[model samples]
Target chain A: METSSPRPRAERARQVADVLRQRITAGAFDDGPLPDEHTLGTQLGATRNAVREALGLLRAEGLVERRQGVGTLVVHPKYGHGLDRLVGLAEALDGYGDVVNEVRSVGIVTPPPATAERLGLVPGAPAVHLERLRRLGGVPLSLDTTYLTADIGVPLLDHDLAGRDLFALIEETSGRRLGRADVVVHAVTAGPDTAALLDVAPGTAVFALDRLTHLDDGRPVDAETLHIRADRLTLRATLHRGPA
Target chain B: METSSPRPRAERARQVADVLRQRITAGAFDDGPLPDEHTLGTQLGATRNAVREALGLLRAEGLVERRQGVGTLVVHPKYGHGLDRLVGLAEALDGYGDVVNEVRSVGIVTPPPATAERLGLVPGAPAVHLERLRRLGGVPLSLDTTYLTADIGVPLLDHDLAGRDLFALIEETSGRRLGRADVVVHAVTAGPDTAALLDVAPGTAVFALDRLTHLDDGRPVDAETLHIRADRLTLRATLHRGPA
Candidate 1:
């Protein structure tokens, strides 16, 4: 196991902070404010100073807030989206809230060479391009841009897009079962336009995902780029160790 | 398909940019500066203005540079780490460079409540805590903090910690095969101390990963938190759509 530096005082505080963070995310404090520092210290078997430092760490992480007279309160924790399975945003966020799609545009255009190659289309072939701003409970969550081979994409233009996931529409239009996807995730600072669309400050950190979805027979069918609010979502996965 | 807003000019520019980005990443220009805008425009069947805007967009993405009297050049691209597999840092980064572990500390300590629970230990049980600063090609990449069950962890104290991965060491020490891990990934701004250690500016974006590893019999054994440099790594995964 790889380890961190062993500064005793800081380590104690980090451990305390870790415990508190888990508690906050688990809704241990959802019903009310966190206990006083001394009380937390006694419960966690840490010193008052350590508990204070722990709270400071949580505050810096945007997990908690200290009010003038209200004490420490847990902030809304981020939702976890599983990465192990291929699911649409609405399916992944089921039970959270209704996901509404604001369709920005839909048209046929010649895709860039790389996109054409990914979709196995001729270099200059036309493809359907779509863009949407997605919201969860009215708060902007992501800006999604998608490209599909014209055969399936053209039919989608006439379908209802505001209340359904593209994955479902693609399957329905093409009558082919979707199988797998290749995804890449990284972090980038939001640009001016993306920031405005996501309702966040310019230069705010955002999660950028590039995905290529394929049919069950291994034909690549959809290419997508999504810029998501980093503060609102976390990616989760369960990975297995292959045989050595 | 859900599409993006269609301002034709901007869309053209973006399409051109996407083509250039693929070429750059594929090492088409690794040996020299990119061709002049006119040549690129002619080659891609795009207007000179669209090509110029595309170059500007690439410049903004830090993937290219417009030097004095020189054309655009590709910067170092981020390495892709597969998130679909449970692999150690060195294993995941094979063929990239040597991954060296700076074992900052290793000792037994009482784990935080959450970590203890994850590792299937009593709340106040002692566990082996280890901290390491991992570097790839001598550049700091991640700071890993780990807690392990003492039975297997205590025996690891005498093993060579710097040159090998903990997964291998654990398997050797405990005579048990590793199974799977649950991981959660999010983005955060680097704190002052972490920034100093990772040699990045404070408030720079970082990827934070929390993971719990289990044995073949489904006993959780290791808990870890890792902070990674976002600029240096992109997480990749192949996901399958299960039966609806």
Candidate 2:
């Protein structure tokens, strides 16, 4: 491939990474001890400085590891966690006792433009918006909002929603089973509303989770938006490599 | 199931969602036309107000859509896009078209605590930290830092790197093939250095991509931390709902 100009340091790092990559891929070295700087410098006919720099580049690319006394070793690929678990949120929050629920506001109104578009409803369709400040052990963790078409459970307006299992309520009232969900995740800073709700300074980092849920029959049932503190939540996935 | 409380509004919305979800999952509703608000309200024995609120909930979940004249309909789930592509940096740069490179600092030094831990090297291991400003075209995009262990590619220090392909050079010089990578993505705000490089005001939102690369024989080779403009870049993944 023809080369384009890159920063001198990047070029150097790339060069070193390539050399190490080839050796590892070609099975030239087992997953064991890597040559020390002195040996590698002499073997590659390069100075120790150059070899060390190259090693840094490889480390940045996750290619080589330098153990304290064991030397550098080759590692394996990591697979992504499958999303079919259908049981992560509860598990993640498990053992964290007493999540505080601050009911920011609950009201019936029309869906916002974005919500309307997703629901395929006419603009200004009547809807209910419930905003909550969720805390773990009294420390705010997330600011979330739920929008629901009003007719499903008209009986809900009068209840104290400050504490309750939303899903359980629906099953009991309508005899409907909750099934699958589709989720979209992204990073965002706390907007004005979330900032106020979570009691964080505006512009704090947050993980946004947008979810669309369905029933056993494939009907869409619920949609929710969650803005969670990045420092508190850990998102992990297991992945598999393909095509070598 | 016995009624826990009389939250009429919440209940109505939940009931409607239950039916809609059940019907959709059962294939009774073919991801198509949802009953109009008036009809759904009557069937659920609730007012249009209640039904509308329920629909709002569904919309938030990304399940239903309401068209101007078309009424409401069920929505299909968005699929996952794998992270296994190993997209080239050049390709990623071209996709944005404004990637600019600013060499924050290019010099040899000892590895940091975090880098050393990940690379399994001792802290202060002789390494080079090359911090750069990565932009798309002329627009500021990300702040990146790459650390290369010394003795790996000191030859890089002698070359001019204003526009080069680091990976290509590495492969050519070392004869190594690039392999799989593991990435950890999270949301964060630009720290002082990143703020300057990205030309964004301090404390602006940014997405952090922490990546580690390995060889076929599973040797850790390199690690890099990328700070990207949150609004501009989107990391998407496709989730496969395993078979029922």
Candidate 3:
């Protein structure tokens, strides 16, 4: 949304910024730091001022960060999501590398009245509560909390989650695979606990994904709340006019 | 994300809050105020304090607002976008009633270098730019900025918007139907201008949707930026195994 009339000299900086934007979006620095401004200037044959301006624009866009001694680090190259995928968050970021599931806790807890209602159980009934931090390359991506009814909850927590997917593990333990989920998406600000785990300031905007996963027999198997850091990830959804 | 052991007395308030959340998410009060504390208590058969706490939770969740003299007002009842609808911002909120498109400005100007590039035009080439504030029931919902290439831009601006969809008008004026768009979604903070128009505090989190719409012949025809108030909008996207 530039308002001033454009000048030819500014083209150099614009071009530099455009190429950098492409690299950031392509996940080129998924695990590494971006090139230093001096290096970019030399390689692109642009002035140091041009490279500086380009990097400044990127920082404003929240794509990269400059630490005191860390130099210029690509803080978050967008997590590009296609609009048709229905996979789990772990599966969605598999291509980005180092999708680590850090299980904070696994135990039976009295379900929240809302969670019980969602799972069609008595209020305050016991349920399997799994709290996890999904990290990519050691940087936390999301806080995932999954609640399962007693039948599935009891067996699922008995086994430690190996390298297998969470959904796959639930299937193995409960002897039933979840078929589908009714999902609700919310744009919310992170609270104290969630903000701490995601390494964002409290009240930072986040994406809250609430899902009720059901079994093949149509019994509600699990209710999950995925709180995703908005700066680190982006999601797409398709809108169809009428039913196909 | 509650930690304390559940108390029996809290159950009543929790139930009250749960029902309120459902109504907010369903856009049940798009243009009205939520019932007052005493009224809610009478309706839900809960104590007044319980109603107060329930409303407090909804406020923290950014659903309802407690105006001093206006009582509790529903602020950001999530705008559930199903994803496939290609309708304009006005049409998208038609269900909410009285979607007003207030054009802030419309004129020809030198496009931002990046926007010009996307439109396949030389730097500083003239393009029609339109800035608008979308209001639902006199409440501002989003700030929309649309840029049209000269071929379509010149003719489109000659007439009033006249309750027409921007894309539909582009096709009417240029005789070319637009096709797909490459959309980039960003969870960003609103700047002073946008924050003021949406009547929200400055730096409030918002959703930045930048889209480059193309013609059936694969020619990029328009570039638009829509800044939606997070308090008012919720977007959903899907994920799949591999590239579709």
Q: Model 1 off-target regions past 4 Å?
A: A1-68, B1-75
Ranked by DockQ, the better of candidates 2 and 3 is 3
lDDT of 1 at A170: 85
**What are the candidates' individual DockQ scores?**
0.48, 0.09, 0.23
lDDT score of residue A97 within candidate 3: 81
Each candidate: RMSD: 3.8, 14.3, 6.3
Clashes of 1: 11
After TM-score superposition, the amount by which residue A179's alpha carbon in candidate 3 deviates from its true location, in angstroms, is 4.5
* Candidate number with the higher TM-score (2 or 3): 3
Q: Write the per-residue lDDT of candidate 2 for residues A127-241, one digit (tens) a residue.
A: 6667666777676777666766565435565664555545555555656666666665555555444555566666666666666655556655555766776644534443333
Fraction of native contacts (fnat) of each candidate: 0.59, 0.15, 0.19
Give Cα distance to truth, residue A108, candidate 2, Å: 5.4
Write model 1 residue lDDT over A77-98, tens digit each, in one string: 5777899999999989999999
lDDT of 3 by residue, B1-244 (tens): 3343234344445445655665577666777887778877765556898788777755766678888888898865677654554556666666667667777667887765556777898876788877767877788887777778888888987665645668767777887766667766566555444566788875566776666787767788778777788777766442222321
Tens digit of lDDT per residue, candidate 2, span B36-84?
A: 8887775555678877877775554334678788887765422222343
As for candidate 3, its clashing pairs are A85-B239, A85-B240, A86-B239, A236-B237, A237-B237, A238-B84, A239-B83, A239-B84, A240-B84
What are the models' TM-scores? Answer: 0.86, 0.54, 0.74
Among these predictions, the greatest DockQ belongs to 1
